[model samples]
Target: MEEREITIVKGKRSTPFSRGILAQTLSQAGAKPELAHRIASEVRAELLAEQRYTVEEEEVLARVRDKLIKKDALVVERLDKWRILRESTEPIVVLIGGATGVGTSTLAADVARRLNIQSVIGTDSIREVLRHAISPDLVPALHKSSYAIKPEDIRIPVKEENTTLYGFRIQASQVAVGVEAIVDRGLKEGTNLVIEGVHLVPEIILDRYRDHPNVCSLVVYLSDEAAHRSRFYIRALGTAMRRPAEEYIAHFGEIRQIHDYIVESARRMGVHTVENFSIENSSDAAVEIVANRVSGIAEKAARRPSSLLLDASARGG
Candidate 1:
């Protein structure tokens, strides 16, 4: 008996070829057409359970047909007799940032979920980590440099478990090291980082990494005047999880001013901007924008020199 050789090609945002292969294999084993289809569906569902598809479900069936066409070409030409194969890997990085209440965190998470990539990292988490490793007094100073905290005699409760405790001690010189660590660990692991915060501007952090090939930095400013003000007021009134109303109310103006400055800085940096006023549709729109941008960056990187990887490797060195 001659063995039939098979080749598999996976498409971006498409169904698994293993399903069709299962159906064909079962049919070759003398199974009925209906039984083969049923068995293939079960097998495909099991295989697909381990992976997530960013593409729509309907597109998967079409993708399967495309894959089958390519397979047919290979079989017709008997190309298996001579092997010529190449594979390229390209990763994408999306740096999403904005003011405190601009829904940056939620947007990052939503984008990550849609892309099926875990690369989202909030800037607040970075700040919190830095604070944890530095002196509490230095936090106010660092915050001042980023213009995120206003000069005031008011004292803030420094949580020991928070990242900003020691972050105040982190110098601008040290920011590169922190960013490198995050990117190497996050992006290399196939997670798209959505680092958000007032300080995530190019002048502050990304300038050090602008030329890196693996990184496609995007600064998203979520603009919503009415909603922003309403959210700020809600925080000022003190939510169930936070401090008293008077405490937040006293600093409302200062916080709002800081956010405005951040938005202005982002605008000056020529960051890709998105006006996210409609909160209801913002998540889906954000996901689409981010995914499309990332896909573009990845496609470009595929054609670029491998030396680009060296740019990422040189970070913090």
Candidate 2:
């Protein structure tokens, strides 16, 4: 027998319920993989058993919330926070940074997916574009790898800072101009974006937008040197040796030095830092951090007086 399709009514539109999408949403809201799928299956089964041909989206949400609240209240809270973020009209901007081999690109993609952000750019891409526009002689730092910066790469040096960090900083600052321009365009155009790269030293880009509720920034690092070293091999293998592990390994000391500098900067600036132990654990932490930041903004907006709220809304705050 052909099964009856369950339709979910949202506003004036209706569509068939999807267990996969529901489960993915649950997972994005901090549910475990197994638990999210199980909950999705259970919700579908319950709806079918009840013979509900058509149900409001609110009913579906209530059912899911009931299931999650009984199992994990925190997950339910995350669900609500995500809902607030999703419903907000403001553009969300996520900035992720890490030294080489720390998986910032991977985590940035994961976080962007979970947040339903459509635009993802890398600082490396920004640097590449800048390289074409400007000459290496004019900006020598832009031509070198962030981890393997030499004294010659930096045209000017900062007093007291080591040549390595100073060169990295100079390169990063040059790229920061492009990064900030992209960020400004995103904010003006109201586009959600996730930008990640080695050059996104939290202090440079993050500090400027730290007070903005819709903006979130964090750094990812691998604390264990062995694990950090092994990731280059794993990454190389995954890429079919397009990015050879040996080259990165040869400069591993310099890469690790840059890693330490970024981590130290993050700590000193009170920025969020996620240790890249495992993707699942780190993704969860990253999502939670975003939820916390956005939720605070939503909550503060809620508490504001109506007149003040209207004024803030008019000013696009």
The TM-score values for the models, in the order shown, are: 0.53, 0.91
User: What lDDT, from 0 to 1, does candidate 2 have?
Assistant: 0.83
For candidate 1, write residues 1-317 as lDDT tens digits: 54222223333322234455445433322234465576557535543564443334334434433444443432212111100100114555656656556666666675454333445666556656776786656545543333223323115455433223123223332444566688777657654455555456555666555665546455545455556656655655455636454543455454455556556755676555566665435554554444444444454444322211112222210
Q: Assess candidate 1 and give its TM-score to the true structure.
A: 0.53
Model 2: residues with Cα > 4 Å off, grouped in runs: 156-161, 298-317
Q: Rate the local accuracy (lDDT) of all candidates.
A: 0.46, 0.83
Alpha-carbon RMSD to native, per candidate: 13.3, 5.8
User: Which portions of model 1 miss their true places by more than 4 Å?
Assistant: 1-60, 63-88, 137-139, 142-177, 184-191, 211-213, 220-224, 233-240, 244-249, 300-317
Worst lDDT 10-window in candidate 2: 304-313
Best-fitting candidate, scored by lDDT:
2
